[model samples]
Target: MLHLRAVCPPEQTDQAIELLRAHAGTAHLIVHRGAAVAPEGDLIEVDLAREAADEVVDSLCALRLDRTGGITLEALDTALSDAADAAEEAAPGEGADAVVWQELLGRTGEESRWNATFQAFLVIACLLAAVGVITDSPVTVVGAMVVGPEFGPLAALAVGAVLRRWDLLRQAAAALAVGFPVAMVFTGAIVLLGDAVGVFDTAAIVGNHEVDFVYQVGEASFVVALLAGAAGMLAMTSAKSAALVGVFISVTTVPAAGYAMVAAVAGSWDRAGYSILQLFVNLVGIVLAAAIVLILRRRKQRSGDLLRPLSRG
Candidate 1:
């Protein structure tokens, strides 16, 4: 469920109220007229089911409430009231299964921001992977995967493709295009520095066998990437965030980039080529799989069965 607060103009208040009151999925509707000072409008608040939030928000926007007034939506983590139960029951589908499209757009937009924190995490993660691959340590490789922030832009890429948001596509693409190379270069320089200090050597790349999977790309890599992408996108869309950790650990994206950079630093072109190929294959598989998942989910949301009102039919 979601809590929606709207500051609506006097003229549009009645229409907005009517829209919410008419919807079976809305409950706990309250109106305090002329209560807002900033926008100078009446304050209206309502509880909306996850399955019905998109429809209600769309209708509210159609009334120009978002332009002249304001709308704030927040998820109800603990809705103990019976009204919340009634709202969910009246909605078209289970809350967990609902795909709130605007919410996803907002979330992806936030995650795709290429700020300093993003760069820091990516570089640190790649550096960890480089060490893990050099030392042939599976535990370190897993740690690198856990620490990597690469999934956000990848998920945003899939979202942009599905929504046809060219700006989002470009932003996400830029993040990936610039982020990977930046991380790799930084990791390579660090590896070279370590070699000069005798902390790492060429034998690390040539003799390692335990973490060799980091550089090996094959049918399994694509299949694993496809599965992870599908699961990750689904988790994001449905707000089941706990499932994303599994997706993060399952994909070999960070490990491949880390290994490739380290191998290149050690003058192992063959290994670098294989690792780069692994990275490319994983990326393509994930984007393709995630886009397909979003496309199918949007289709399901548009279907009459899910959109039909529960109260009427």
Candidate 2:
């Protein structure tokens, strides 16, 4: 369920109230006239199911409430009232599977930005991957994957493709276009510094078959990437963020990039080519899987049969 808070002008208040009343999914509607000081309008609050949230928000936006007033929707984590139950029952689909397109747009838009913290995590993760490749340590590789923040932009890119949002596509593209090269260059420089300090040597980087998995491209890598991509889409669309960690570890994106950087630094064009190919395969698989999921989900939502309530089970 979702908790919606709205501020509406005096003239629009009645129409807004009527809209809520007409929808069986809304409950416990409350109104306070002339209560808002900033926009100076009536304050209205209601609880509605996730399945109905998109339509309601769109209808409200049609009134230009988002421009003149405000409309906010938040998850109703623990709705103790029976009215909440009735609201969910009245809605078309289950909360978990509902798309809530507006929320998704807002989330992806914010996450796709190429901000300072994003670059820091990207660089640090790549550096860690470089260390893992040089030391032949799978633990360090996993740690790098966990620390990498690359998934956000990837997911945003998929979301953008689904929604046809050019801004989101542009932001996600820029993040990847700039982020990976920068991380690789920085990791290469770090490798040089480590070699100077006797921390990394050519032999340590060469004979490590254990870490060689990062560069090897084959059917298994593609399969794993596809599964991880689907799981990642689920994590982003639903409230199951715990699965995101699994998505991070399952895909070899960061590790591959790191290994490619190390291979390039050592002037091993063959190994570098393999690593780059692996990275490319994983990236294409993930993006394709995510885009497919989003497209199917959007279709299901449109058909009004996407999410089934727990009670229906």
Candidate 3:
């Protein structure tokens, strides 16, 4: 279930009421006329089922309330009322399968931005992976994998492609285009400095096989990347955050970047090239898999799954 809070202009109050009053999934409705001080309108609230949210929100958007006033939505972890149960039962589809496009676009827009905090986390992850690869530590590589924030933009890219949003596509592209190279340059500089001081060498990279998988790109690497991408997208759309950690650990994006920079510092261009290829493979796999899932989800949501109750019947 979801709680929808909408501020309606005085002129549109009756229309908004007329809309929600007729929806079967509206378990509860409250109207406070002239209560919106800032917006100078009425405050309308509705407890609606998750499956019916997209339909209702679209209707609300059609009224231009999103521009004139505002609408906010929040998911209810638990609803004990019989009215709520009836609303859920009355809705067309399962709550778990609902794909609220507005919510997704909002979330991915934020995630796709290149910010200081995101940069810090990526650089930190790269540094960690650099150390891990040099020491042949799989544990440290996994730690790096968990810390990387690369998936945010990748998922955003997938969303943009499916939704045909050019702005989102550009935002995600700029983030990845600038962010990875910056991090790699920083990592590479650090590695070269460490080598000059006799703190690092090519011997470690050439002989290290324990964490060699970070650089070796093959069929298995692409398959793992695809699986992780699909899982990550499903988790995002369904609001299942716990599954995201597994996605992070399953893909080798961060580790590949680390290996690429570290190998370049050791003057192993061949290995560095391969490491970059590994990174590309993971990224392409994730985007491709996620885009396919989003297409299928949008189709399902737009098909015969939606049901509308007769107005005021």
Candidate 4:
């Protein structure tokens, strides 16, 4: 659910209220006129269900309240009121299983954009992975995985597949297809240069025992990917973003990519291929898991709405 607090001039209050009313799917109306301490205008509070949040926000944006006059909008977090509880109880099964794919797509698109922050994260993750492989430290490898930002694109791709949004799928695929290879090449070059300078050696790459752990593919890897993907999607949508850090640390894609680069530099083509395969396995598992979850959520939403008609009568 979403709660909004708006301080708008007398002239804009009516329009703002209208916008909220029109877009909010199950809004429990609350009007407190002329009870604001802002000394500028009335304080209008709006409470909306979670499913209706996106539409209500869109309507609010359309009003241009931010630009027009001295209007301020603030989001509030609060428990549902009795009225809201009653409304939910009355509606029962209505919209219970709605997928809200467009909302999820919008979120994916926003997070998966190829931006400077993402590039920096990618570089850092790859660097960490290379360093980890050279040092033969599982801790460092996990750190590198945690630092990687590749999951956003992967999640976006899964969402695209579920929604059948070709544009989103294309953008996500390009990012993943282009981004990982680029990171690998750059890291591989670094490894090569380091090797030439005697800063890294074949023994450090091949003798370092961490390669065995990353190259082996099994049900554990698939399960980890599946759990990470679900947690990632939840983190993206949920207010608790801090949990995503944990999700990032749990995946092996970055570590495997880094290991692959190290193996290539050390002239261990077999190990390099194995590492690459491991990375692919994890990536595919994550995308498939996320897509399935999204599809299920959508189906549940549809079933809920079908059972209960919009009109109470």
Candidate 5:
């Protein structure tokens, strides 16, 4: 459900209220009038049904309340007395399935900006991967995976493609274009330093069959990427974020990128190529899968019939 707050000028208040009241779903409405507020008009609070949230939000967007005055919308989770019975009756068919594309797209827009925190995370992730390669510690490798913030941009890319948001697409592509090369270069520098200190040798880095195998592309890599993409989308859209840990582990972005840096430092072009290939495969799979998921989810919502109001007993 959503709780919407709209504060507008005195003249426009009635129009806005009417538009909100006429929204597609059942809504409990409250109105407050105040003069001190800059808007100096009306403040409305609406508790709307969950099933009709998307349509309600769409309608609100159409009203362009922000341009008219000051409008803020917040989703409320508190159960209203009047809504409890209706919720109980509707619970059975309220499957976990919900189209979250719009929400996901909205969130991506909110978080896609390049900031200091993003830069710090990227640097730290690369450094961790470099250390892991030098030490050959799988634990450090996992740490790098957890620390890597590349997923945000990757997710933004998929969301942008699905929504056809050019701004998001540009931002996401820029992040990737700038981030990966920088990380790889930093990792390469660390490898060079480690070699100088006798902490790592070219032969030790390349001879590790396990690391080599990670770089080799196969059908299973595609499957893992696809599954990880779907899981990632679900994690981002749903309230459950713990599921993202599993998705992160399944994707080879950090591992492959780490391996590539190690191979480059060791002057092993074949391994570097393989690692790059793996990275490419995983990226392609995730984007394609996310796009498909969004399309299908939207289709389901469009096809489902809306629930009717219950009669009083």
Candidate 6:
């Protein structure tokens, strides 16, 4: 279930009430006229079925309430009321499968940005992977993979493609374009300095066959990329934070990028090429997989899955 808090202008209060009352999925509607001081409007609150959220939100948007007032939605982790249950039962789809566009857009919007913290995390994660590659340590590589924040933009890019949002797509592109290269350059410089001090060398980077999978581009790379991509998208859309961690370590994006830098600095052109290819494969595979999932989800939502209640298992 979803809880909605909408502030409606006086002129639109009747329309809002009419719309909510007409919807079978809406329940526990409470109206406080002239209660919203900041927006100077009536405060309307209701509990809605997850499946019905998109339609209701769209209606509100169409009414221009989004511009004139405000609407905020929150997921109900547990709703014990029979009224809530009836509302859910009256709705069209399962809560778990509902595609709450507003929530998704808000989530991806924040994540897709190349903020200072995101950049710092990326650099730090890549540097850790660089160390892992040089030391031939699987643990350090996994640590770097978990720390990398590249998935945010990648997920955003997938969402943008599915929704046809050019702004989001461009922002995601710029983030990856700028963030990765910058991290790689910094990692490469670190490698160069380490090389100058005799602490890093080409042999250590190229001879680690145990972790060669990080740089080796082959059939398995594509498979892992596809799986990771799908899992990543599911995590983002479903609010599965724990599953997200698995997606992080399951793919080679960060490690490959770090390896590319390390190999380039060591003058191992072939190794660098392999690492770069691995990175590209992972990126393409993930985006493609994620885009497919998002499109399918959108389709399902349109098919009234978003309006139907979940069947008790």
lDDT of each: 0.89, 0.87, 0.89, 0.71, 0.70, 0.87
lDDT of 5 by residue, 1-313 (tens): 5566766667766876776565544456777876427756677777655555555556556676556655454556576575544543443234245444456777776666667777678778777766676567777777887888777787888889877898998998887777788778877887788787987775577565444545878999999899988888767765555887887767778778878888888888888898899989998888778777777766667766344333222
- Tell me model 2's lDDT, rounded to 2 decimals: 0.87
User: In candidate 1, what are the lDDT values of residues 49-155, reduced to their tens digit?
Assistant: 98888888888999988899999889988888898888888888778888888788888888887888888999999999999988889899999999998888898
Q: Write the per-residue lDDT of candidate 3 for residues 55-156, one digit (tens) a residue.
A: 889999999999999999998988899989988888877777787788888889999999898888999999899999998889999999999999999999
Quote the lDDT for 131 in model 6.
91
Candidate 1 ranges beyond 4 A from true positions: 305-307, 310-313
Estimate, for each residue in 17-124, the C-alpha lDDT of model 4 and write its tens digit. Answer: 776655424455555677656556667776655555544555555665544433332233565578665444554443333333445666688767777777778877
Per-candidate TM-score against the hidden true structure: 0.95, 0.93, 0.95, 0.75, 0.85, 0.93
Candidate 2 structure, TM-score to reference: 0.93
- By summed lDDT, the worst window of 10 consecutive residues in model 1 runs over 304-313
The pairs that clash in candidate 2 are none
lDDT of 5 at 272: 85
Q: Which model, 2 or 5, shows the larger lDDT?
A: 2
Per-structure clash totals for the candidates: 0, 0, 0, 3, 0, 8
Candidate 2 local Cα displacement, residue 252, angstroms: 0.8
The Cα error of candidate 2 at residue 213, in Å, is 1.3
- Candidate 6 residue spans exceeding 4 A from truth: 198-202, 239-241, 305-313
lDDT of 5: 0.70
* All candidates in order of TM-score, best leading: 1, 3, 2, 6, 5, 4
Query: Which pairs of residues collide in model 6?
Result: 51-306, 91-307, 92-307, 92-308, 92-309, 93-307, 93-308, 93-309
